[model samples]
Target chain A: MLDSKQMITIKGTKDGLTLFIDDHSSFEAILDELSDKLSEYKPKKDEPVVPVTVKLGDRYLNDRQKKQLNELISAKNCFTIHAFDSNVVHRDEALTWKEESEIRVVNRIVRSGQVLEYVGDLLLVGDVNPGGKVITTGNIFIMGNLLGIAHAGVNGDRDAVIAASYMKPNQLRIADYISRAPDYDSEGVYMECGLIDKEQDKIVIDRLQVLSRKRKDISGFERRMLNG
Target chain B: MGEAIVITSGKGGVGKTTTTANIGTALALMEKKVCLIDTDIGLRNLDVIMGLENRIIYDIVDVIEQRCKLKQALIKDKRFDYLSLLPAAQTSDKAAVTKDGMETIVSELKQEYDYIIIDCPAGIEQGFQNAVTGADKAIVITTPEKSSVRDADRIVGLLENESIDPPKLVINRIRNHMMKNGDMLDIDDIIQILSIDLIGIVVDDDEVIKASNNGEPIALQGNSKASIAYRNIARRMLGETVPLQSLEDEKGMFYKVKKFFGMRT
Candidate 1:
């Protein structure tokens, strides 16, 4: 009952092109159409570089679909994937993040005896008191002090990260990795972030600036696209 | 008209009764007519703490039941001129008092007194409900320990839910050396956890214990640091902004001598 154009549509963006895929179609059928469309938009050697936004609406691509997309993108170096976003975030039963994730932001201080549990990521702009708790299915970002317990990626997603202005929390959990309070003083130290490194299989707490390397890598791409 | 206030804490042994007695006496010393009410009916201690035990002939339950006049139940403070106590009945239970009855009694006293301070029992039971029923404001007491702070947080939430103004906190029994050494929580830590305005902070002093044992309020002591804290709290309650006193400069030769013997700092 569906038309070919309706299943997958690509439009020119300000700096690039955006591909809007109808999430109602089967993954296999959509991926098949997406490849054909990408080939059509393939830029010539002398053509300008254009960033590509793949908006899947509420659905995210599965592992096999992602692999196929990667191969197709590698074969053609014309398109740059700017953002890949979906509306739905999935959580596992045992405190871990799966292939899906969402975000919730709270601006008020979490007082003692208060407990906040979100299904995906949580970004807070206030402090968490000693007896307070913030539990999330994905990463946690605390703009203020985090003196209480924080459990991120509760369903087994090892890639979850937690960052805070004051990261001297009573306890921190990322996926199945749990770390108790480390001997860290809060004098002059303003920023801290934590992540569960898969290779080390242990949680790592580092200066928040460590994330700048990753962010700068992406920013460099934008600069290169603008110049080259 | 008088303002009624309740001193409460969710956990036991956090010094609600002592705070009520000291604050009431301190206010009375400042030429304010204060009436101390004990709402912990079956388990009364304000009378004993104030040393007005023998004078309590007609208890709060007696006045509520109309067995005696309200004036007859109020025991005048023996030493403090402008202070009085409405003692609770040892034989009665918290169910004997109703919210409406307490409101009426407080209103009646408001006509003659400048302040009526209620000493609420420890816990969130009927006693706490009865005590806080007539209060226009509340002062929550807590120690620096984890359990006390946790309970105070819960009580503050309940007070907000009941539409009681966000209660000001009083962190009692803070040992400064321990706080500096990271063994105990400091005032800043407590304030962060409770997330409420701080009314006062009393230091851990032996005078507080001695004064309680003698039924004498530490606020009556001229040189005690705890007394200074209580006086500031009373003045602040009267709409005056009093700056918190720092204990560092006061730690002189006496503190060094005490610390030399490895006395519990």
Candidate 2:
């Protein structure tokens, strides 16, 4: 048994229009009705007709069908198409967006076979365990232990810095230059490594002087001891 | 609840499928509810390895497409009482399942099973993405060869991006003799470069090939070297602190005698 009295609704959106077909109605008849409507409404030379969605009861068109419709609409070169399973709001901006700030992974432990890489600044909040690697096109900051390999300035930025809390990496690199950590253990010495001279530098076990914010209440002798 | 663990390597013929089959069967033998999801799609082989090819009436695509429920597509393992398989679709391509689809399927399966092992397809593409979408952890399989290790490194990189923590490594088809003679890179070399915890090491065994050909994983065979390695891995995955077996233990008496004579073993 077929129902010819069933109604189908078609509406236009920013990108295209949605076509709603009753589940009991014939798909071919619905297409005929749409064509008849298009013939009567004949769009302008620049304006195009696109089918963004086709809903038949609860079973909407699948991705394959949506892509097919998108292709057909693009062939006409009039309007864009965006399809979904349910009602979708029209958006003026492009659906895809590129973020300015790169992805950051903090305090992350990269275990064996685990890699942490990003296109922007990659700040590790924890250790890059042995068997773990961190690669980045920008600067790499490891706030904790860095016993793993790390490659910074992957895009040939020589100014990129590879800083770590412990500053002991099995392998470390900045731009094209590579350096290995001191295999032999050292005593409680804080180190910060970066380019100080014209060439790439690795300052292992070298402490950076911290500028003390002194108070006026401190005496000269006490201030000398504190500053020293 | 079952945790989806994808055994992946970016390179081909690096023993990804072999590792998946062994780990899946080993976990099942340990009385844990397990399911092996073959995300290879058109190149499905987990079914063949598990010997459930003849039992597959519904493929994963059918379930994802809503032609059938998830249960109707699962093929129970004949060897293990608690094991089941969710075979990938052969007729359809890898595009049949999205990352969201995989996440949804794994979430549903996690409630019923103890371990969900995904046999990922080789290469870092859509198939790889689909396999790892819902993985709570990852097991990367690689051989002793340099190229295999390189690809495994990239796979490790991929798992890290997916926010999957503590990816385990299984060095497959290792030849201890070559390693001892310094002709090949040892475990220490790989550990130094890759910097991950070693879960297990499988020696080069003829039994694995024979068992795979017969559609049976060597893990089901007791007393075999590969089976022991698989069991050790299962133990480690269960939070057991099992030490890696020494390579000297695998050497025969004749080799040890030769070593005593300052000769190459």
Share of reference contacts kept by candidate 2: 0.11
Model 2, runs deviating above 4 Å:
A1-228, B249-265
Instruction: Report the C-alpha lDDT of model 1 over B1-265, residue by residue, as the tens digit.
Output: 9989999999999889989999998999899999999998888888888888878789998888899999988998998679989999999866889888898999999999999999999988888888888788999999999899988887886686575677998999888889899788788878876778999998888899899988888888898988998999999998899998785646688889999999976
- Residue lDDT tens for model 2, A10-99: 776665677666655554565556555545554577654454665555545555755654554455454455544443322321121111
- Model 1: colliding residue pairs: A95-A154, A95-A155, A96-A154, A96-A155, A96-A156
DockQ each: 0.29, 0.07
Candidate 2: residue B10 Cα off by (Å): 1.7
Quote the RMSD, in angstroms, for model 1: 10.3
Model 1 chain A: worst 10 consecutive residues (lDDT sum): A93-102
Q: What are the lDDT scores of the predictions, listed in order?
A: 0.81, 0.73
